[model samples]
Target: MAGKIRVLDPDVVVKIAGGEVIERPASVVKELVENSLDAGARKITVEVEAGGRRLIRVSDDGCGMSQEDAVMAFQRHATSKIRTAEDLYRITTLGFRGEALPSIASVSHVELLTREHDSDVGTKVVVEGGVITQLSSVGCPAGTIVTVRNLFYNVPARLKFMRSPASEFNYITEMLIKFILAHTDVSFTLRHDGKDVLCYSSEATGGDLRSAVAVVWGSDTASELIPIELSTPKVRISGLTSKPSLTKSSRSHQVVILNGRFIKHQGIALAITHAYQKTILPNRHPVCVLRIDIDPQLVDVNVHPTKAEVKFANEAEIQRLVVEAIELALGRTIVVPTIALKPQPKPATVKALKRAEDAFGKLLRSKLQIGTEQTAQTDLTASKTHAVTSAENVVMVTTPETKPSEKHVGIGISGGELVDWHEILMSLHPVAQLHKTYILAEAPNGFCIISQHRAHERIIYESLCQKETRAKAVQWLVTPITLNVGQAEVNFVVEHLEAFSSVGFEIEHFGGGTLVVRSIPAIMVNQPYAQILRDIISELMLEQQMRTLEELIDALRASVACKSAIKAGEVLSIAEMEQLLSDLSKTEKPFICPHGQPVALTITDEELRRHFER
Candidate 1:
């Protein structure tokens, strides 16, 4: 015998249904704001306490609901945005499912006060946990004000999973940024815990999108953005995108608005990123606010509960338009290369300077003997052993001694015999630079190719990890750079000021969102400090904000190495290439770069013979 299935209680069913529409405090804010927008509200005010867990109040100047409709607004499946079944296919409003008001009312205590412009009296309705507790006529302005309190009180499970107040506030702030940018014509004011955090007046008759973007992303970032505009037979795309010079470490700043509604469409995101593939570095995302206007019939907005995702009829067409618009906009904008600061000599103590001079003498003497091109090939080939196909032929060398005056000039030998390998990598004469990027060298067996940038990056990254190397003398700036940033970014930079100092950057707050960079790492003096500092800060804010001091130093070190390393197109002399290889061989992890890219590869003689059909 099987147990009989029973229907859930009416109260339990409503609460369960509410969970689908309202997952967190940010969801509640999103739904309410969209409703206000749909009501044709030109002016709106949003206030929250305890990150919307304690109270949320939204006031709008749109036309208020009538007495009869006010009572029906909380009932399931009731809505004013749609009338017939066919209306679902073409949703022009930000919300049309009619699930927001009722679902929200089911999970919290709701108070609604409203009045019509022609009516003398208004209606006030109070609801708690899906029950109508009170209703009456009242005197009020010709608008609507909905206040929600004790969210998720009826469902303890949901309340238990709510994030911290600060985390919740960040999410609410991010959601509002999207809405504010999407509907620039509507004025919005947001208050948290009695303090006004964000305020945006309604745009003028013809307002630039840069003004709106500046309100959230700071004016510095907005000024660097380029306007993207494109029109097709069936679509019109217009927005602002950051120039290739201004990229972000994360995709958080990219906003996509479709048909005046904020959405998260992956196809559109991919198109925007693809446009920047050749301009920006790998793993970095561009910042853009793209608005796509397509016929309502060609899109389905009801696919997701939150309506953040939409299904396009022809996604490929939309993608093509987006890519073309961004590419065209970028082609018109000029991107000048950043100029590096003047090079400066590194300061050293008396004893260290004496030892360095001795090391230079030793290096010069060894170079004179082994660096001759003819001697290099003959001596290297003489050390080659027979049967190169044996696995033991690949010999591993020990990490080079770091003593300044120490030198290993003789070929590595075991049992008084000339082995097939040498300890010093500089002994293998570098043949030439391959396209000015890779160091091509002839080893005892076959050939070794090393990526100059990746090799140098690994060396600098390991150097920053050691105490001796980090005692790195600093190069003081003659004219300090004063950076002005937003309040959020300012706070982040100030908090991590000490972390910056650990990696050989000297910075001091100059009051009111301004910081002066007084000095930088000695080795990086000739690199572009302005761009490198900003990039490091942005990357730290994105991925390492919560990291420990040690972790932050390591992360910044890797970033500094990449920025200061030799670029691919730049030419390097033979001495510079030899120095790069020698430094690379001394690093802890020499084969791969800090980013996990292979630094060097070796082609054994056996494989070379097989390639020739031996």
Candidate 2:
């Protein structure tokens, strides 16, 4: 028999459509809170129990609904945000989909109580699983209070997919933080399990967003941020960005607000990253609360179901403005890195050994057998290695031991002390820094240039790797330092406490979103251990997505290498350059950084002569 097609039941259709908007407990919070914001609410309260699975409540002091409007609000496709099709294009409110209320009501047991300021009585509507069970007049305050119980109870399949209580709560906590940051004029209070978790007053800062940021991310981090405001003929951008010295591992710290709504756009993020090119490390991202205002007609906010993503008609132009804004803010910084250089005696000899540099070096050389001694100095182009180009000379080799996503390159160092000029590093006397970035040296081959950051990164990476494999001991602190982070970061630290301990960090909870660091790794001594640890944790969080415990330690090594490495734009003394070259020669992979960036490049004397036509 042939199968016949039939339309689903009306109730089943409503539930299916509602599931799209109310996929998880966090989704419910987003819709209801956005409704509160759009309703001209001055104060909003959010309470949840059992990670929003058993109960969810949202109350607001705003224009409450009338008896008639309260009943129709739960019907599908009913909205007051807009009326005509033209209104959709110029949406200024946070929510205009007309699906949140009805969709939410269809999936959970919902109770709505509302009373206008002029109304003598309030309306009470009880709905269970998209069906209206009761409706009557009730006494209530002026505003709206929505209570949802047993979310996803009607759909056991959806309920089965919910994450752990703590994880779900983390998502809700993060969402609320974003809303609070976006609206400084609205007072927000959040409670979990009957305990007050967050209480922010709108009047506390006099409408200052930085004060609001301070309340969430801490005062020290707030103080380190720079203000950004730029205007073009077509677009305007205004926001706050942390200094280059302050960065996190993930892009999660960056919040991109499009027009008046929160959105995620890759083009804008790329523009900001390009602006911080040489100042911040590649793996780290700056914390920014960027708001871009463009003509509503030039953007589309209906791209995603949750409205977290948006598309711009002139994306390239908008990206340009984002870069210019960040650059303008960074240009005003008086960043003068102080470098201490002590005079060191020059060596009498420079020589090369025929044997490989290290155990790893031996294996690399024997397996690749890349070039002969005579051609080694001449084959400097990118093709001889993996994706090695003439411009960058990058060769990324991936091994089982290394991260699959990370690129790696092999380097050859002329081993042993020298009595004669046979080594590349020593033979090429390092003269000066080129724009305070690359080291200019006179090499026997022709010229030797070193990337200061990559060179230092290699040295530190190898040192940390050794320490990790050897079960390094912690260097106890005389005065313990306390680190302040957000609640989510604190939870992450608590969960990975043992991982930190394995890397020689002795930290413990000190109550109130603070962790006291009693000791740290010996290699990270004399540096800002607190900032370093934070960076390490940030890096670990990213790597944890695809890495195991053993792999996490390797990722930690890379992070420590980047953090402790000497930064670009730093003035180096002659002695410092001498020591850098000397120390670099001793590392296992002297020519490539841990992240596979080239530490040094050499141009042969013959190639130089050919270019000169000599």
Candidate 3:
């Protein structure tokens, strides 16, 4: 059988392993960022061109490695972070695997320029396709600068899977945001094609996380945060969250960190969503940045090669701690009133009026005063001629009493004050709530529906969303509420001060794990403020497991809708129903509310007839 198969090349085996580490541009970004963090770089800069497809440059002012260490860095599994199997269980460094550098070098053209602080000369190395082509001594700054080019050149299939430059850039930006959130004390700058996208500088204050977040996300987000400080024998949790009203339609805004490492945890996300339940609409997400600190032995960071997900020894306890922290922080904040505003009606078009006239010609014409003067003039002329022929200077003419045509009358009412109301209702007809959630009204052939809550939610959402980036309008409360929480919950509250203020909740940290609440969301002013906040937090904790802050916000909006919606059994007057119908007709997606639930239902005339069997 010719001794089975020929032996595989060692170079090919290395190249295959490289494929596992460097999958895409985002993968490259992750490796480079981790390397910078490991280098003890207080400041780092990343620049990309062509969405990192053409070039990727990372420069850092960390204590550069010696010539020997720099040369050994390109070898697989060569790491200073770990010495044995036990070290893997307790990893503190960001890039402990050491495979990232070697793996990356195997797949692309890489150039490294690094010099130790004590060395007068730097070492330069160039590697292409897993082969070291050059190594030389050169004079350079006391730092390291790595440039990678032509990624996946050997693998055409992988290159083909790359997305457009814009999309790839978005991914890079997202990765940058994660790093920025994780290491707020480290100043970072990012540029795309020589254009600065982000420039963050850490603050001397302990809240560098918030400062960094404000720079990348916006100042408004920082303002909405309520300070959270929580500690326990087993765990510590802290971070910020957007108020229920500041929900978004996407998860782009949520950031979570586990033990100083950025990660995406479904359990934590679901907890946040649970907290915002009944406060935000469905499908809407909120803005949040949370960090969890726990004993190193309690969590496993080696579950994934990328370390973006982790398994905790006591996940349930961690979840409880996080939820409790957020709940307690919210309880201390004052609840303010949120005013709902009605949307403006669209102006009537000439075509619409013409259509109405065509449907009921004489009735519409009479009601609108169209051709009325001409009819009166013709009647007067005929009466004058008849009067001239009369002998006693008075015309004794028999005239029939004119009755209004049914077709000429508008819909709803016959006459009196109800006439205007009837006309308005008729003009707004073919009204139906689409998806049983939003109201849809006929407009020419097509129709529009209103998302009663989302429309209101959007308005509030926008205001709160902006507060994270800009100065927000704040309302004061008359009474200050006190809330008691554990240590970990306090940390979470402090992390999200700006997010809280944006939604009109004002709070201050009182001594000994107590928060003083001064204001709350205006919409929920009449309700039990403390209890509502507590419930929201509890729900947030539950939701954090499955959703991000943005998703949680949506859940909260739905919660608010349920509490504020018109009750099902309540009777509505004709005018009230008409108004509701008209409003529903104007909405964009009136058939469905923020949640997936329908806002209204419809029974066709045929279906009604069938049901009655008339």
Candidate 4:
């Protein structure tokens, strides 16, 4: 038998390596954003159409490249940041690998327009599938504008794996947010399809991360963040942490950066979380932005192909530092204002007036009592009042009135009323509200309680979930919305077209890697379709290797529930609250939401009495 022959082409090797570099539009985004940062760009503007499938244009007012350098940038392993192996140890620039440009160009149709400040002329280069189709000198302003299109066009297999535009767009936004937090000195703008999604102006307060966070996340959440600064010989840690009251249900709000590079490290995240173990409720994550700056030699960024994960030389020490810093910061007392009670007037009586006069002596006491009496009549009976008096023995006399039915009445309990305990308590019929959030109704020995909002959420969540599963209705648009996507995303849509239809999305592929959305699911008609499609694609792509279609569909439904659920602090009327409580009582798992957060928490009358020392 003849020996088996094996041949490995260099082009095949290059293409395989390229796959690791350019995985999606977000990958391209990461490279471009890093490049802008490395070039010392103070302001970077990223504009994407069709979730960066049709076009991903990054314009930066950084030091642009020369004609020769622009042409060389497309070649594999070409970089200005590193030269020899030793240079890697002290690497500071974000795009040192030099593989980003060539890798991106190899997988997409790339157009580069760049000009240096010193040069009057600019260079324009166009590359498709690693082949340079055009290179010319042109007149242009100083800076760089990189436009990537037709991603994964040559690799049909890879193209088939791209996520929906909305999903991709979210990923892009997440990446942008990371960069914005990391570099507060650099102004960033993100525009999608001619509409601006985010705009951040550079802060004058010496690169405050809080300002950037306030711009991206709402100001309400950002306002609660407290500053943290710590330094040691090996590392420096600085950032902000949200107050305990502002914790979120998910870890999405936490932002961690290692040496100005955004990273996803479970160790560091767990360290911060462990520090806050008891202070924050279980399942609730604190909002934080932590930046750790250590010597470059101590970190190995090369460990991950995406460079989003790094290995630290002294992880234990780093963890200790992070934990200690967070713990110390949280231990400090925070002053929150309490409602002030209104002052009340003493009852006018000869004996009371004589006692007051004796306490304060004649002249001062008489004047104060006269002023108090004048203001007493203006105070409404229903208004809250606080009384200041030295006389300990006080009595109120009132005529007995007909008692209402014990089963129907609810009254507030007073401390002194316990003397005639049985008679007063039986007549009062005061019901306990759990956590001051729900009412507990008595029914002989065993009692049923009602959840105010959870009941409402459960009813709404189940009804929506059922509607989603039974018969999803499509809301057709009079005018179709067209979105440009990468060739890969187009392939993904084609592969999952039937699934999309099942979800009541009327989408058809337009020529040249574009999708025209004619209708959305009736449930999501008001939602941004581009964003919804992108989210669906991302969900599908993330679990493509691990889950079946049915599992993915379930995950999608959960996401919809999470998005549509009524948030906390929404005021409800008595009828609405009652309806919500009734619905919550009907749910199988009435105590918890789908995300595993407590829908309602109950504190019994016994527990309340213990707390109040009753």
Candidate 5:
């Protein structure tokens, strides 16, 4: 056989290259728009029909090309950006590969009309299936306009894979939004089916990122955005990040513009996420429009034809920069989310609830039993001053088993109720907090014990969902605390005092690099403020990089749920136990803590009889 790798046919080579560069109508729009931007276009207009499968037209008021250059632009690997090996390493322009036009023309009928800045008439060139069909001189505007008709006319396989018209149009709109965000100075207009679908006017924005954000996202998003600006010797990072209260369910709203082109870099994305991990609620992503301007020579954009991804010379440093900028902005802002009534999650289906009720139905056949062991330190006395009398208690009562189909009231959503635990727990009369670690109460189904720490954790986390959550809830300490620490720690606390203030610590600069704490978080009112403040400051010092203040604050708040929780061995009065039970009942998840630990357990009469062999 002839040499197996003999030169392939030109048409086959063209198809192979086109497949890599042009995947869909959105790909065509991205390439064409980038080309217009590279030409220094002040104002550009894009028109599409049938989601760019039938036609696509891009017109730009840029310095048009000469007659000779207009024809040469169609040739493969021909570009004005770079010509040598060294230039390839530092490609600056977006279309330096020079394959967009040739690949696009190879499958579609394309017409190019252009005129130079000083030329009297423009040049018109027609291309079909990568061949020159006609050429003429015509009177036209002092700019370039390219018309592409019937995309994938010769490539039926590619056309077959195109998405629905609306889906394809959405892809194009998203691409245009990225461009609009990155290039605020240049006006852009996108027309679909001859109707103006999206437009960004240049005169109104004055090249502001907020204006771009308002146009792409709504004005509400723009107003909530906090500006991020950080400049190093080799890196410049700028963007608009949402406040702690503003978050989204998906990362679709996040974009990173690197070196004038929007791209996907995993390290950069992770950096942004890591910064916001504790700042926003779990599973919620912050709306980000990060722009990284770095030296072009340090980036390798030649990894792919589409340039959707890039390789950075020093990715770690870039990630650090991203984190610091985000953290600095967040540290100065309050971190409570929008608070509303926290509705209880949907309960198990009726069948599922029945199964559970049936599994524990053995209790109904057993007699009411009361344990005499009081070693757990739970006082079972009637306290008239506590508002909970012994007569109102369910500990010694004979309660009929609730039918699985009976309607029960809950503290959460309207017309919604829990099946078992909620019904039993809310009817509980507070006996005492057991050993100061567990809570003992007289439930309708005998008695139940609750883990004090775990119950309080659920209460704290659920409070974040309800009204007046974590923002500015202050508890003035009876005595001001004066903490002595290393100078660096003191300086860090002083410099980032807003971080402490936002989390509800009213601290003032005490003389000689010490801080005087006058107030503490409402949640930590029972805890020792001096020790906790020391621990908070000490933990902050261990962080080598600039972690988001909110991240650190979140860690502290989470720890508060544990360290500040009612200890197991500590004693609880009847009144405190009553209040704790009431607060626990109000939470969406009264049975589980934020860490998935069980908060409460029912001591059924059946189980008690089995222990005593009654």
Candidate 6:
């Protein structure tokens, strides 16, 4: 009889251990690059071919290892960073476990060339599938060079799970960015397929984080970044945070480099959010690059394999430190870019644009019953077009100041999709504004109530939808508005500028995470165009926000309508009320707004009787 679990072979054990550390080319790069930084490397170069499936070479100019040390490095649990068990509690170096080299070598063919500065010659060691195949003395530079080839060739299962070459390369690029941002003292050059993709020279700025941020995010964002510095007994925090105006839709732009390694802490994130609560909206996240130096004894880096996560002794205190530092930095500066719009010569086109804007809410002459009541008829037809504008829009509406005549109006949307709702809305006679928020109306059956804000939101939403074509009205900003939104949004905007153009926004990339807006949808021109751009980008960047290219234009329309819609507290004249209800009747979904909020609620005669117990 055999035991259910037999001891695995040496090769099997090494390969299995390697799987834990070397998941992809990015993982390989992460481990090797950290080793270079740990060796006090001043210059590091990473080269990849075929997204690291063919080869990955990481060369660093630092203190290299001797021939004996080069051979011993392939063995597991051998490390110069630590010696005893007690050292695990106070782990300071990035590569302390000493498993990175052995694990990487076990799953791939590796060649290491190293020479100390005082040594006349260097040693070359080659490893294949967890075995040292060759070791020889060679002449080389006074540094270390690690070349990995045919990664995961022995593990066909792992190779099958690899993503596309470009995707894998992107992952590698993203990982390198973290290392580059974490260590600004070292110069880094990354090449893919023999083309220089990114380069950073440490010769300039001498470890200025703002300069690094300028390289990664952009100079515009770096210029506006506020420096934060604070020292406590247990924690020292120093880094840069974006101004109140410069923020990202997501937290990916926020980075917390703990000690010398990048990490994520929920308490720290909440602290950042709390600090900027008064300045930014709840949904928006401020961009930050913070380095928190704390006593090693208080942190447990052994909690994760990759050391991307850490455990703090006093999380609340650390969070408080971060919050205070950021808040203090924010209080110290009040600088924002100001733009002076270039004056445009007012021509006949100006009047034409105004008239077009005014015509948005101006209803064409039509006969419809104001109410289903069989009482009387009054002449209230004199006031044809009256401005019923909100504080945010120049909407005009047609109403009666003279006489009333029989007029007609006419949605099948079961909320998600479309049904017939206009018949019921058309019959309701608006009585008066209740609390200046809702409109009370009378019906033949019982009565109806409408939320003025939601009703206008629906009206505006449909109007924007109707105008979502090349025929859209474009309001050109005299002086192009430039916005520093960040790398992710910049990539998105550049890739989908056509989507923006299709809906009437003429935006172009102005280099380095900055966008210049030449024009915007005429409907949203009066609103804060920059903020609108930010908000739209914010919403569109949300997970699953865009399903197809068509939805891109739809999102623009919806965002613009929501911003341009009338709100509560604005007093509406009778003409405005009638025009609003009349417009709502014409929409595809009159029962609910674009956001799915109820525009109007109706009580039938039966329901009213039941409520009153009549």
Candidate number of the best TM-score: 6
Candidate 1 lands at a TM-score of: 0.71
Q: For each candidate, what is the lDDT?
A: 0.74, 0.73, 0.62, 0.66, 0.70, 0.75
TM-score of each: 0.71, 0.69, 0.60, 0.61, 0.58, 0.72
At residue 413, give the lDDT of candidate 3.
20
Candidate 4 structure quality by residue, lDDT tens digits, 1-614: 97688676866776787899888899999999899899889989999999888899999989999989998898888899999999877778777888888888877899999999999999999998888999999998789999999888778898777866766776787788889889999998888889776678885535677767766664555777888778999799889988776665567778899888999999999998998897877877888999999999998887778888888888998999999888778777474745435222222332344544232233222221122332233222232222323221121211124443332222222322212212221222225555655555442222344444444444434544565333423456666767554333554566567666655566898764467887655444434555556545544554444345665555555555444333344444433333344334434444445544554322345445667884
Off by over 4 Å in 4: 1-5, 203-206, 335-614
lDDT of 1 by residue, 1-614 (tens): 87799899998999988999999888888998888888888888889899899998888988888989999999898898899989988889988878888999999999999888789999999999878999999999888999999999999999888866645665677788788889988888888899887777765523457887777667777888999999988899999998898887677778999988989988988998999999998878888999999889999998988888989988999999999999999999988887547443343332233343322233222221111222222232233222324433234332234221122222231222333332335446688999878888877666778788887887777766778656543556767777655434554566667878987788888764467788777556545676678777766665633357777777778887787676687676676666666656555556667776777666656566778974
Query: Compared with the true structure, what per-residue lDDT tens digits does model 3 show for residues 9-102?
Result: 9988887888877878888888988888888888889998988999888999898988899989999999899999998778888778888888
Worst 10 residues of 4 by lDDT: 390-399
For residue 129, what is the lDDT in candidate 2?
A: 87
RMSD, candidate 3, Å: 17.0
Residues 1-614 of candidate 5: C-alpha lDDT, one tens digit per residue = 67777788989999889889988888888988888889899898989898788888999988889889889989988888888979977777887988988988898999999998799999999999999999999998888999999888999998778865655666677788899988899999889899776678878888888987776665656878998999998889998999976665556678899888999888988898899888666666788999999888888988888999999998888899999999988887776655445222222221233343221122211100011121122333433232232321212222335332222211211112224343455577877665668777776546777777677776665553343545424555656766544333444566567767766677887754356787766556434556567656644444424356666566555554554555557566565666567657655657667656667666666667779995
> In candidate 6, what are the lDDT values of residues 39-158, reduced to their tens digit?
989999999998899999999999999999999998998899999888988888998988999999998999999999999999999999879999999999999999999999999999
The better-scoring model by lDDT among 3 and 4 is 4
Q: Show pairs that collide, candidate 4.
A: 53-486, 159-488, 166-534, 167-534, 167-535, 342-386, 455-584
Better of 1 and 3 by TM-score: 1
Model 1, CA-based lDDT: 0.74
For TM-score, candidate 3 versus 6, the one ahead is 6
Model 2, which residues run further than 4 Å from truth? Answer: 338-472, 494-513, 521-523, 526-528, 539-614
Which whole-number lDDT from 0 to 100 does residue 130 have in model 2? 80
